[model samples]
Target: MEGFPEKGIKMGNMTIKDIAKKCGVGVSTVSRAMNNHPDINPKTKELIMKTIEEFNYVPNNSARNLKRIQSKAIAVLVKGIGNTFFSDIVSGLERECQKKNYSCILQHVEEQEDELDIALHIIKEKKLQGLIFLGGSFSHPKEKMEQLEVPYVLSTIRTAGENCEQYAAVSVDDFKESYKMTEYLLQLGHERIAILTAPKEDESIGKLRLMGYAQALKDKKIPVQEELIGYMDAKKDRYSFQTGYKLTKELLKKTDFTALYATSDTLAIGACRALKEAGISVPDECSVAGFDGMEAGEFYIPSITTIRQPVEKIAKATAELLFDMIKGKEVPRQLVFEGELLERESTAFSSCHESVK
Candidate 1:
């Protein structure tokens, strides 16, 4: 009766007994009403349900399952599988799980795979206590989420087309952060800036960042040039160095710009390689910037400028939030972290439109 209130269970934590008193019925009658017992009056059951909803009485459904002794475990579902940035996050989650004495199961969800369907299957087959979803554009409906009964956390994801009540999330605000990076580039006097980003079809982080980039240019009265934007090749990895390198190489042949910004550090590094090959000195002939402050950026010949997301903190917080929800002590919520803009060697001040000279 922990959830039950005192003084006929009316004032504090609500119990079935309180509900029964409010309905002017016996405890068995209230139980019957809640359970949809055939013996209960239909109108009486409907009244009880309304009261339950009004009072927000949630029954502990896990009590029965908790009795079954199973090794505690949680699942981490990664979309885009092997992306290096996610590797750090996944490793962090694994370590956190170890500290909590819980097992971590990682499932790499393919770009085309239906993640929710896969998650439902895993939850039942593995009997996981909780779940952590990494990467991917989330588009599941409330129904789809209900199917995933266990509490789950979405890390580094931008969810669309659904109510957020179904899950908790940990990530930087993609739009504002992207805008910050773009504005930084603008402030450097780079007028004709080009962006190497994800495809037109991406509805996730890529889309948000792209919009932010566009907004930054607009605020500065610079018309967003379609030719300056390089949408990722459908055939290439969206966040890969190869994609960045190829796009920059392609851009060099077609347009002129003083600055180039890639959505990820890996892509930015690739851009640097392409620039070096073309005899264009970084921050001298062409400035560059990237998102995600990966360690590789720090060591690159011309250390890359980037927005550093707090990966370790986000990862640990993700696990803690999910575990708290699993224990019925917390509710689903979104937590956005601030990113640090590190102006490194790869970018420099340039007053004139250098073009691809």
Candidate 2:
């Protein structure tokens, strides 16, 4: 057999022709061996492998992906990776993908409108087998995805004004969970409860959670006070600890609410800080609660009371649904998961009656 070149050149510059020459085999034989072709003899494949190692040959992703036809790789596109909620969803999706001997590719759009177009372009050009939209709103033309015949699922969040019946989704019953949490607060004798949320139309979560809050208060024979409700722009800034802090401060100034329910955990944490700094004790002077049971909530100075969504379960169910769709099996179009209320130090019965005395 021929010998490999000296180990001076970069591996990226190494090509199949170089490997074929060094192995004393045809380019086709080297190609077959690299791709694990059945026609190649074991001994010859073994010889090619040795030469490939010596030369440090690296396969070209673009060319190899084209020849494979089916990548056996799924793309998971989300709004942000830093969010704990999305991270749990990804962990769940990864578990199912690994079981089926498939790979998962994560992509984040950061809520930019143009990124959706780029994602659609990549799907069509790459011929990806499947796509999982984890979060964020995808408003691009659906005709492209439909024409490519690619199976796609929306997880954690659903597309508004789209025919959801035509696709599959895994999401929590936000409206129900929000309503339940509000009802719990009201049951504790909090008629002046405040709702802190982002804009309604931009995110379905905001709209649903706010509706639940309103419904619960109305059902309890309590008047819905406009001043007690807070709204912020969901797309204005990244959902961070600071956003929660600022919004909470504003809400506290706008209303004298005896209880506050933030739509997200981050917001709730911020609200807690603002309340403390303002000389108001949580669950005593004013009760506080939030959605999304983030890990940080457990260690918070006074652990936060919040709602917990089964993020892992949702991810696993989404992956299973996608797998079924790939195998031509008809699965349910929509799967709704329930939320659990985590009771902690941040919330308690209203102190309004005691203050009156």
Candidate 3:
């Protein structure tokens, strides 16, 4: 019920406190209203929002985040919002950040979003001390990499080109891990193994994983069937459960295989769902394997077989690497960890060994 601002002040100069003063409310009330908190009265929030709208008040994140020149905060930019595999990594990052007296901001980049562009904008706006890139295929040219001026670490993703030597990274050897999983499937006598993975053009982890799968097949004297490869749709969420489901359904229609290996645990679960709807028995009829070692895979209906990477260790290491680089304590480097393959309910020895191609 208070009066509005005078016509003289610049739009950007109006603060949340100014809005609160005009609304006869506290700054916290204005903040909760702006963010749509559940506990606020509908009418009060509506009034606050309308008052904010009338003034064209936009929060200046840069000013709010920076204490002086730095924010004391780090960002974890995850490429896909739907990937559950990144959840634990996020938690680990948050914990490590808190232990180091830094704030953590989690950001999600939609499927096919340009991560570097978004990251550059976020770093400027938030005055972030460093960045921890959680997912997405990073094969940026040096020009693009150089644009990200702040210290950053790539976790659980792959990067290529000579410019990668300039950044910090922590992850498993996707190529080696994939080879191990595929060889396990092959040892189970699965000659016609189908791989659900990233598109061929992907030059990151997806490419490495696919390479490992191909190498395992060649070593076993099994020709890599071109038709059996399941590539992710560019328009859909990559490394996602639904992507896995849809791709598996399409693969079933076009090819015949005794076993399936999904590049992620979420994808593996999706593949299992598709196989279930098709009335195909898991392990008994078709062995399935997954990567990422997410806990969800462990509790699923049949319990998934997967190559488990130490999520906490990798995440903490990623944080440590980024912080060290930011503090000028270390040079940018790639940290590789070993992955363990777990044999579980989702995979079994091929039932049709005699019928195998």
Give per-model TM-scores: 0.77, 0.76, 0.79
Q: What digit string (tens of lDDT, one per residue) describes model 1 on residues 128-230? A: 9899988776777777788788889889886644575456889898889999999999888888999998877676688889999999999999999999998
The pairs that clash in candidate 1 are none
Give a tens-digit lDDT track for model 2, residues 1-357. Answer: 234446765565677887877778899999999878999989999999997887677766557676443567788887756667678778889989998867788877765454456567767766677778876644445665465356778887765545656668888888899999999888777889887876655545667788889999888888888888777665674455666778778887877888999888877888888888899998888888888888888788678888988887888889988888877795549889988999999888887666532
What local distance difference test score does each model get?
A: 0.85, 0.77, 0.88
Residue 41 in model 2: shift from native, Å? 24
Query: How big is the RMSD of model 1?
Result: 13.2
Model 2 lDDT at residue 182: 97
| Candidate 2 whole-model C-alpha lDDT, 0 to 1 | 0.77
Q: Over the stretch 167-202, how does candidate 3's per-residue lDDT look in tens digits?
A: 788999999999999999988888899999887778
Backbone clashes in model 2, listed as residue pairs: none
Candidate 1: residue 106 Cα off by (Å): 1.2
Model 1 is weakest, by summed lDDT over 10 consecutive residues, at 2-11
**lDDT for position 47 in model 1:** 88
lDDT of 3 at 346: 97
